[model samples]
Target: MTDHALVLFSGGQDSATCLAWALDRFPHVETLGFDYGQRHRVELEVRAAFRERLARENPAWAARLGPDHLLTLDALREVSDTALTRETEITMQANGLPSTFVPGRNLLFVTFAAALAYRRGLRHLVAGMCETDYSGYPDCRDDTLKALQVAINLGMDRRFVLHTPLMWRDKKATWALAARLGGAALVEAIRVETHSCYLGDRTTLHAWGFGCGTCPACELRQRGWEAWAADPGKDETHD
Candidate 1:
């Protein structure tokens, strides 16, 4: 039997790319999105629309990649102290965690994904968290994910794999990966359809993903895209 992989998708560039990657690798892939009261409800809406589009375009792909897929909106809404999920205005710091960082977010999200995977007899849980463009979020680091993996296993009395396909890769490499798996069309679709701006502004494009082009997330995304566009050869993965 082909092993099933559960993806923690956020309907953003990285997560959407990771979802595509999972689709290419695993015969059985399901996506789980969190609607954590994010300031950008647009992201959740896009996620639902993407899911629907997939179902309409390729029902088999949707069936294999959608049946266990879910959106946990209420769970995130209940915890609204973070700016990303609440009304608080985001504050960007030079070298510290941004106000956009949601406390215990990935922990809670992955825990839930793991629980769902365990119940379904799936051993793999995939997430798209990159340390390179993460902007000081402690939870986005490799160490945090490794530690969480161990904790999840101990807590659930079962072994589970948390796969971060984008952990070591930068945005340029990520864009290349998307192209490799599904060509430029997929990459373009991701940029156009996904939501990355913490503030929900979608008027312009930032290098890493689409956003306000001013927030730290937008800055990192913009820089990455500029870097890649300047030198496509920089990404060895590019064909």
Candidate 2:
């Protein structure tokens, strides 16, 4: 695989950390995001603002980071009935995986990203998918991602490395990683700028990010921060 990589940026804490990971490793890096009829579309706005900030404040890194590309999957609107896209009050848990779990969302995202990577001659596709301290989403598992990597490569007839920097790291470790990657400023920005709230509520800011503070994602992040603030000695194993 070549050195250039494309990151699946969602402007969330994990993806932002993974972007920094790509910046630290590969010489050439870019970002790709999707608009798949998600109610949390505000993250896209944050994504654009993040790229703009990187270009303005950190020009040296931003130059190699390249442009942030956004694509739309309008079909998702018709098929998905999840709270993330539907006009229903978001539900934390249900009979099975939470109502937020859009079926095959990650699968579709990575496949499309792989195609884009092949077309652009990029060899690596980085994403921020975590199993620990994450919502019960099967697609976020490592095995699922690994299988998809092989399938995508064979389907595209190209060798594309899929990098998931946040697969094992919990939310606390993710914050520490952000501190290591972009230092204090980036950490602070991630806390305030990124929106991980399932309800898309930024009115009540939490220690980690803006959220409704009651949703599963927000609860997980808050717990991680509690642990992080206790003994956050720059430890990668903050969890």
Candidate 3:
């Protein structure tokens, strides 16, 4: 594996923290984002500013940060009719999955990211897909990612390692990761800049971040914040 890496940054709390992790480990780190016509497309709008802030505030990360690539996969919306792509209410489906779960979203994301990384000569691909604190998307599971990694390497004939820093950690621990990565500055950036609302609601801002505060994403973030606030040291033992 080379020292270069590509992070599948979604301008969300998890992905931003993963970006920090990438920057800390990889001397050359780039970012890749997909625009699948999500309801919360505002998340895409915040990426540049957050990257700018990180580069401006942290010289070390700035030195390692590379170009960011945003690819529009509008076809994903044409195929996926989830709440994340439409104005439907966020609810649990009869299949035991959340309505916001976009089928094959992360799968496609990693595949595309792998393609880009192959062209860029990046040997490592980092993402924030987590089964621990997520919308119960099967594609986010560690097993799925591991299997996909093998397929990607076989199909592309290149060894690309997939790194999921938040796979085992819950949302509270994700917050702790940000704090540990870049201290209060990274945490504040994630709290203020990242967007994770399934409703696309950015009109209101909460301590955890901006969202409808009632959607599953917002609720999970809120709960994580509350838990982390109560005991910030709880994640100190996490690997």
Candidate 4:
């Protein structure tokens, strides 16, 4: 197997940053995205453009960047009735998690990613799942992913390292990470090319990105952008 990595790029701010992180670390890195019939499927639209711009940001990254893959997991819609999969309102469940939590989304994502990695001879899997500043998706927890890594390795009988660079990072720190990876150019690319709205609204453009500015994703992004813009120096500890 090769020492290449496969990043679960969702065309969101965090995933874009993680992609850059992978390119910086790995000699060869590929990207994988899912089309699970999400309401914000618009995020998929910007993936190609973001990757193009990201490659141009650095010569080494362009050379290290490899093939891109997209998977159509329409089964998620059949199994998930969350706001992200349907037109329902975003709300907190009685269990205290957001309605946007797709039951096994991240689990399925990594599982499939592992399967793909097996065939592609890629040894590392990277994703942008975070619990620090997010809708309380249980699947995004560190414990969940750690356990999943063990399960995948056992079931597949292959050693694979799952990397979650943004696991402990908040949005402001995530923005800082983008700036660190590709400077103001990368930050602007994320601001303009990434999509994180749950409502799939792309008409209005905010300083952070394009979204309704009221959804949990937009609010979190906007808050982080404002915080970072006010004082990026406060992100020293983020590294």
Q: Of the candidates numbered 2 and 4, which has the greater lDDT value?
A: 4
Give the per-residue lDDT of model 2 (tens digit) for 40-141: 788888987776665565666777887678889988777888888887866656467888888889999999898888888899999999887788799999
| TM-score: model 1 vs. ground truth | 0.86
**Per-residue CA lDDT of candidate 4, range 1-239, in tens?**
55799999998888999999899889999999999999999999999999998887778899999999999999999998999998999998899988998998899999999999999999999999998998888899999999999999999999999999989988989888878878889899999999999898999998889999999999999999999998785345343
Off by over 4 Å in 2: 92-95, 237-239
Q: After superposition, how far is residue 111 of candidate 4 from its true place, in Å?
A: 0.3
lDDT of 1 by residue, 126-215 (tens): 899878767677888999999999999999998898889888888878777777766666666776778877788877764455678776
Cα lDDT tens digits, model 3, 23-94, are: 989999999989999999999999999999999889999999999999999999999989999998888999
**1 against 4, candidate with superior TM-score:** 4
Identify the superior model by lDDT, candidate 1 or candidate 4.
Answer: 4
**After TM-score superposition, what is the CA distance of residue 10 in candidate 4 from its true location, in Å?**
0.9
- Put the candidates in TM-score order, highest first: 3, 4, 2, 1
Per-candidate Cα lDDT values, in order, are 0.76, 0.82, 0.91, 0.91
TM-score between model 2 and native: 0.93
Candidate 4 residues lying further than 4 Å off, grouped into runs, are 234-239
Best by TM-score: 3
TM-score of each: 0.86, 0.93, 0.97, 0.97
Model 3 residue runs over 4 Å out of place are: 237-239
